[model samples]
Target: MIKDYVSDITFQNLSHKHMSFERVFRNIEQFMEKDPTGNFKLMFGTDSQVFSRETRFITGIVIQQERKGVWACFRKVTIPRRMTNLYERISYETTLTEEVVALFTDEKKDSLIDIVLPNIYKGASLSIEGHIDIGSGKRNKTSIFVKEMMSRINTIGLKPKIKPDSFVASSYANRFTK
Candidate 1:
């Protein structure tokens, strides 16, 4: 059973009325075909905001091609009120990102993988980046978990990016969590 159900997702920059996980991959492929020369980066990230009764988690997938702007999709999930610890919240956010990545990777296994694999393995500059909300700034409380969270993301074979650089989480998804 899917414990964390995703409700009401949409691609922020697309005109399409409805968007699903499969559609997200399809849109990326179509974008690649339309602009073969453009440098493309796929990013996945999650952020959360706590309310009095629940915690809202927002996960986003962004496809960016150099100079051509960006296309993104987001899903929001709400869970019952829980712990307020910073570490626990960050860890939960990471888990949400991992879940999204797994779902997308699994969906890409049959058709999209063949097309994406070449770009990925042939040094074509195409890659996937996992953006974490943690930062290294002195004023940021999440900074302390940078190393540990980065290590976790690295173990999953994703290029991890922390704040100042992790806009997918800190900016895009963060907006929806509110």
Candidate 2:
């Protein structure tokens, strides 16, 4: 039933149906601006699922400031045909994460960091993390591809997380893939 490839660069915001990257970026900006004193983690990750004759991928962009609040949104990309290769799918997922991360240029990241720097002594901070859906457990089918995928994420300077700790990818993004 899958038609063809579709790419949606706009993000799905909690308060709105679709937003351009700029709006989504500002949304988080306003979110953090509301409480710059809370700890923050800006996370990005991607996950995929195979439908009847195609594959659908969803990438989540999340910002969590604990007690302050958490903001999340996702973008979807689809391929016309089902992709059964574990390695291929995982690679594509990581690629999607990288692409999204690139959108938040160094200048943009520094701006976000600027918001939390003054409170560093007070425990306020920010970290950018990339989550890959692959795992390292022996029985995990995606285990074999962990190194390659993590390396890809690492090349872009994102602290990579996997399996149990990679909820952004395995959980958040996975929810939208369905």
Model 1, 110: alpha-carbon shift in Å?
8.7
C-alpha TM-scores of all predictions: 0.82, 0.92
Please write out the lDDT profile of model 2 over residues 38-132, one tens digit for every residue: 79999999999999999999999999997766899998889999999888888899989998998888999998999998888988889889999
lDDT (CA) per prediction: 0.78, 0.88
Model 1: per-residue lDDT, tens digit, 30-122? 876675556778898989998998999888888888778887887677889954899999998998888778765545633444555556545
Among all candidates shown, the one with the greatest TM-score: 2
Write down the worst ten-residue block by lDDT for model 1: 3-12
65 Cα displacement, candidate 1 (Å): 0.2
In model 2, the clashing pairs are: none
Stretches of model 2 off by over 4 angstroms after superposition: 1-8
In model 1, the runs with Cα more than 4 Å from the true position are: 1-18, 106-124
lDDT of 1 at 108: 66
